[model samples]
Target: MTRAGRPTRTVLAVDGGNSKTDVALVREDGVVLAAARGGAFLPQTAGVGAAVDVIAETVRQALAPAAGAPPYADHISAYLAGADLPIEEERLRDELIARGYGGSVVVGNDTFALLRAGARDPWGVAVVCGAGINAVGVSPGGEVARFPALGRLSGDWGGGYHLGEEALWHAARAADGRGPATALADAVLACFGTATVEEAVIGLHLGGLQIARLHALVPPLLAAASAGDPVARSLVERQAEEVALLGVVAMRRVGLLGEPCEVVLGGGVLTARDPLLMSLIERRFAECAPHARLVVADVPPIVGAVLLGLDRLGAPPEAYERVRAHFSGAAGRAAGDASGEEVLTAPAG
Candidate 1:
């Protein structure tokens, strides 16, 4: 509450992804009170209730030292992975509201958070190529264009995990003489510390080595591509094509194809800024959507979640600055500082 004795408006902002979850408590004036990180929010595998439970635990940790009690915030802005369909988002929103975490709730695909985080304006396109791939677009008139993003079933590809599998596929085929020999064979073997690609494949199949480690192969795959390995370069080129295609299609769908539009790119793969992949992406966008201005997201998606909440509360520009400063400053202190548990006191009135 403010020193004037009026009730304070707060926002419970959450960004949950396949890798981790981030929660922050921010006053309507943009003062960040607390933040915490938790496990993945996998609604498909863990079920909707269990997935939200993860967020609940993290929110509890963030608010334990704060001054408020239940319904800690005026609104809950949750941008989560696995909330792909409108039905899924609705179900999650209903569940969150049922918990009475806040007076109101808004749930959206995490790609929306990525869009809000990077785009110069509220309306633009966001393409995230992290553990998985997805795209979302918002038109100036408030029209939204988004994909189902159900992986292969939804005609999506070119994420870290998928690239890893592709690298192994080509390497295994090359090792067996079924495909053209390339440097990826050796790169794959070295990535897994195995003498042969076959050993890595067998290990993955037998669960001796975790399949998640496949994501690690992406670096070597990109390196091989950068070093002029034909097979690796082809894979990277394909990934670039897909990324540009998603953005272009989204822009076309939203009637931004001929006009100038911001194409915000995020996720681990794109953020790595590999020379070859980025170059190819730029070229593809140039050819396909000439006016598309590509921008790599500089801030985490959690910031977007907070911004969305602030937008809902009709926060002022000063509020936006304060929230950005807090998270950006925390980020500068340590690479992973923002993801750790933290509680802060609001400034004196």
Candidate 2:
């Protein structure tokens, strides 16, 4: 309890991604008082202040029904997208602290959340292939390894957005006789409702269609690959290679390649569980790191944030189980709800 005779909120756990931000107010005992989801946390594009404001607004909505006041939690565990470097994490941490949102704050790249969410132990590797691609590893002794993750400029490849662009590129070339004809041309035309790949290209170039809409092409591209389209299959194969390579290299850097370790795979692309892609990824890992175990994260990344917060608070083991059970039940209910919103909360008792 606080000096005000109210229960202390132990952690304001946040998992902010490129598309959405999830916030949960968790007690030291693992009871979740309030939770909410909000818009993108794109610090790179929206500026640090604006990106944090999104989290602030979402927190306000979450805390509205709960019995709390300023300094809602003892600590803030914010694992966020766009915080790809130590400097970026520091900037965001400083901003959250300046706002007086919590008594203390810790910020890290979202890949860390993915790692904690999926891996059975605290130390392992995580590879995220979402709108962008990145990898991170943590050693038992607290050493860290990560990538610049600046997309192609940083020697990175394979993500849903990049795959979509590749689909478009191949389709356009095939239509123009510059590349071998493949079903990707038909897939692209069907995806954009265009008569030809050129029309879709023109639409993208002239702003008739949002460039982000290209993400929609990923599903069709995967479907084509599953159906054995040579060009599509090649792209999927390359993506699998990149995913496996990121995990293998991170494990090697952290001295886990020769040891038994879990390689947690998260992000939308990996979670989709496309059979062909999964098979290829498994094969690569089997050949490269036989001792490594690959696991696709079954829970949302916010669970990792909550767990990290609990870890910082030195909460008991039961606290961890309580939080995991809460989210697991919430996920089950969410599957049945038609609203499609990812909100989870438990009434104060």
User: Per-residue alpha-carbon lDDT of model 2 for 1-349, expressed as tens digits?
Assistant: 5524665558999999988999999998889989999999999999999999999888988987663556778999999999998999999999999888899899999999888877767889999999999999999999899999999989999899999999999999999999988888998888888998999999999999789877788889999999989999999999999998999999999889999888888899988888888888888888888877788777889989999998898877888878877887788744443221222121222
Residue pair clashes in candidate 1: none
- Judge candidate 2 at residue 56 and give its lDDT: 88
Backbone N/Cα/C clashes per model: 0, 0
- C-alpha lDDT score of every prediction, in listed order: 0.88, 0.87
Model 2 lDDT on a 0 to 1 scale: 0.87
lDDT score at residue 200, model 1, on the 0-100 scale: 92
TM-score per candidate: 0.92, 0.92
Residues 111-201 of candidate 1: C-alpha lDDT, one tens digit per residue: 9988888876789999999998999989999999999999899898889999999999999999999999988888887888899899999
lDDT of 1: 0.88
Q: Cα RMSDs of all predictions? A: 7.0, 6.7
